[model samples]
Target: MLYQEKHRPQLHFTPKENWINDPNGLVYYEGEYHLFYQRNPHSNDHADMHWGHATSTDLYHWEEHGIALAPDELGTIFSGSAVVDKNNTSGLFESASGGLVAIFTHDGESQQQSIAYSEDKGRTWIKYEGNPVIPNTKIKDFRDPKVSWHEDSKKWVMALACGDHIQFYNSPNLIDWTYLSSFGKEYPSHIGVWECPDLLYLPVEGSSKKEWVLIVSINADGPNGGSAVYYFTGSFDGKVFHPNEKPEDALKWADAGKDFYAAVSWDNTEDTYWIGWMSNWQYAGVMPVSPWRSAMSLARKISLYEKDGNLLLKQTPVIADNRKEAASYQDVTIQPDTAESYAISDTAQIDLRISEASSSTKWGVKFVTDQEEVFQLAIDTQENTYTFYRTEGMIDFSEEFPEEIKGTLNGLDVQNLTAIVDRSSVELFLNNGLTVSTNLIYPQGTVTQLEVFAVNDVLQIDNVSWTQLKSIWN
Candidate 1:
């Protein structure tokens, strides 16, 4: 079983075959979650883009519904969003049953926005005859339209990524867009062209006032490297947005990890949730894909919290990984360059807290075999950084592969951390989601042991928690 399909993720969302990227059109209606993705049907490589559909009553087990939308005269279907038009906004509803609308990008001679609707659940789809609803003005990079209904404005708002910045469009109905404003001009990091854009309102963690969050995904030059999602918090008064952060700290990463990208929230009336593509495009095309290429990250509930006067995103996985606590440590003191081993599964979650985290402290946790380490997580009190690396045990090791990814917290005073491990992925929630590191790791063989060690000085590790996770397929 390991030789045939060792890297195939049993937990993440992978198709039966071929290529997949960017979780598109996430919506919740009638007690079911609808997920549309960007896929290529012909081969393992990316090409003829189409919208692949899937449905899940609970976020864990999914049922693929084949292609939802295909290439038309307008062009191939690209990344976009889905929403339930409760009041028949577009008037495309044949009756009360026909109100689910999907807004997506049509990539042809140029890029433009289009709409499609399904009256009977999401089994069937019909494209709007009036496509290219928001025509492109020859912008070199114009795509990925994320639309949401604004209650305060009493209209629909669209957040479209346009080159270096994002454009805001408003419409009374789902059609007939009126340009409002543009953002992201030298205010934040612009290492690559912004692709997916998501704008939503989140209430401050403890306060009553809610703030708007703008999320942008870039291909390269992430803080930790490769593809990542960066977000900005500000005020959106129906038309324009005002940045609430200091100029130097305007943009913040959604996750400090290298894999999480193209993340967008699910449209819900009660709770806010999001999902992301769990592989980096840097080496996506070359992964050892037999029947399938990539998968989506675990669905996570998105919430806002305020600490030290900054609004931070707290992500909690929808599906718990706790099969049982296999091993644990409490108030263990480690000497310099000393290591300790614990029993763990290939898929697991580890929670740790430090009693004293200071400049002279350096610690690392390794997933290894008899000979070498397969994966490693490091924390440096001196540098004030957290690092995750998949340098060894990779099936197809390449110099082209991304290097160790790193993220930072103020004063590097991280006391608590949660690490979720899967067959080919790892998600690190540092300081309770203040910092996140999600990485893809294809080990050469099964991981055999877990070792925790300290360097430079004696470190006190306390409040340790361990869980041998169950398979999501089960």
Candidate 2:
């Protein structure tokens, strides 16, 4: 059934056959969110890139539309962001200015930023004849336009991913863009080529204190292995960014997961929502099957909180409204002394809280198998931290040790963990949804089991619930 296999990690709505990657033009317009992506319309491989379009009332159930934009003599419609033009003022949408504006990279002979307008709310798009609004400045790998209207500046600002640094541009209208200064030059060692840049202002812990964040996905270097999102926390003073002191002080990865990449945020939304391509570069192009490739992480609502003087980004499921079928298992606890197992069908979400721990105890839950193959999320009470380890399974981990993939430990006194497991991915939220790690696992069979165990101390399972998820698209 897996055909035209693509490179990105996908959630529920994968077509039976096609190629998909790098979520583009993510915009909330006309009471629905529109998602465009990089796809090869004619075949299952990467060749002629086109913009594949889909829309959803909520982030979950998506309605696929025709190819939104294709390669012209001008170039292929590369990655970009979209905006809703409330007033029919921008001539880009001639008949109706109150439609949508798409700013993307046109990669013909060279890479340049281009603008396109949609009249019927993104159903159709017309490229601006006076194209290449931002000419290629000899920076070979320049693309992925993330544009937003800055209310304070009364203009549109763009964060374009340039090699090593993110280039900023200012525009009075959507058409004309002027190059501004670049950030991250001083911290060249900290990042590689920055791609898929997103800049937004968000409140800290529901407080009035708001800070602007510039998020860039680094393609060449990451904490895990491949690409990762690095953020800068600072204030934008109309023209340039005044960043914080240390790069790591302000820089942060979007997710502690293996599969997250090229994440972009929707524009002009009160609630901060974003989506990411969910496959790693290491595993791209080597998937088991083909015809259809790539997937998106479920849209996530983002928030910021500070713990131990470090800024952490929290992502929650934003597709709750589109959840058509949900089955819940409530208040199930296990004692620390023994190992217990429970059966899970296809896809399930579970929450666990482990209490009564000492310095020399281990507690965790295993998935997908009773022996040889299972994904494990555990806490070493002795180490006073949490760990995520996987045994023999769909992943061929014959060389590396099991503990190599161990994630950040929430310190001693860590008690709660919430986890969501679909067919091929696992997201673990530890210490009351504070620290998290996302991993991708291809389980061997359909009949999966949830197993839990503890070493020394009497492990107490405070609350455990597993909910079955129904298919979103038929």
Candidate 3:
């Protein structure tokens, strides 16, 4: 009966109690995926930061291992990355196959970088005696070091968030570090401070080349006015990162939704698996959930691709194997200004494909409960935008919770889209995640109806299918 609390997510990762934000120390080792997060162990609110640990063999069923790193004299733990020192690089292990080393931010009189190691697969951790390996340089907003090994440079590279930009540094054995160069001078920034920075090399789709991607998460002034992650496609030398300038004037968001912040990728995985904190700072402390206050987004497989001579990132969910197909439809049509409704499971994955349609049309789908709770997604072809709103659900927890968020389609045809609806959230992946929107919704009644409608023009549904996702709590 544990985790059966109301509004709990059945398919995502959430701490059993207290509060969690900014996923940290994501790594895979010895057939287990380790997810450490910024946790407040004493309350359901954000405070007294610590590193909470969990492990999963399949990344779906997680087992909590309690607190892995506690608040010490140096300060409470902030956010950071973890790596496997297979060659005894830090010399912290007995065998050549070294253990796990975590590079994180210690938040005390300012924020500084620190490290700890675990020999027994992250079951326990020992703080480094020489803590604060990288001291703060009088910068008030410095934290969240994401470290990775540079095979070409033969050194460990750390991407640290320093005030307005990211600072690059190189270390030989995860201990001594030297500053390299800084980025974000020419990049656009919002009204908020930057927190987490991740540097990743992703293979460009349809090409043999791989490009470097620098991801930065900003708060308070996102496109939707909360926490959001945006990135720049660039080239990273051992000493510096040169961003490839894009033609667009606005910031390129990783997720075009109200949620999805503090995103980071797992180290030492076969493929790039990215996850983010599934709540916004604007209302995270006031979410109307019990026992658990926040949850993590579904681990998504991300890739880089080229479109119109511009390199972009795409995200696709790592679907579980236990999902069952519940319904199917094909070649359905709806007249202008009309809608068709269907009953659906509370937890389900809906996939739909639209045939080539007129550019003057406006169509959408709405999820509803018997009590009139509603969450809607709409595509305006004339405006070349897709918009979403969750204004009719149980959204009174925060005054800032009710708003509409939109993403530009840029004249792309309405080909396909997927909506993964859980107990308290919905993840909309449009055009194979070339554009994604993730939002949290709370309905006092179970969402039992889905309605498809078109406005001013006919809508064509090429194919549609529905699958009921199994609950992990079961």
Off by over 4 Å in 3: 246-248, 357-360
Which is better, 1 or 3, measured by lDDT? 3
Q: What is the C-alpha lDDT of each candidate?
A: 0.82, 0.72, 0.88
Question: Measured by C-alpha RMSD in angstroms, how accurate is candidate 1?
Answer: 2.3
By TM-score, highest first, what's the ranking?
3, 1, 2
lDDT of 1: 0.82
lDDT of 3 by residue, 1-474 (tens): 788777899889888888999999999999999999999989999899999998888877788888999989989999999999989899988889999999999999888899999999999999999998998899998899999999999999999998788899999999999999998856666478888999999988778999999999999878888899998888988889988875356677899899899999999997899899999999999998878889999989988878897877889997768675588888788888889887887788988888775332688899898788888999886787898987877878798898888887645666788998988999999888888889998888888888888888778888877889888767
Report the lDDT tens digits of candidate 1 across residue range 28-77.
Answer: 98988988999998988878999998888878777888899999898999
Query: What is the TM-score of each predicted model, taking all chains together?
Result: 0.94, 0.89, 0.97
Checking candidate 1 for backbone clashes, the offending pairs are 98-119
Query: Candidate 3: global Cα-lDDT?
Result: 0.88
Q: Write the per-residue lDDT of candidate 2 for residues 193-268, one digit (tens) a residue.
A: 7789888887778567778888878875776557667677778986788876475443455665667789889876
Error of 2 at 334 (Å): 4.3
| RMSD (Å) per prediction | 2.3, 3.4, 1.4
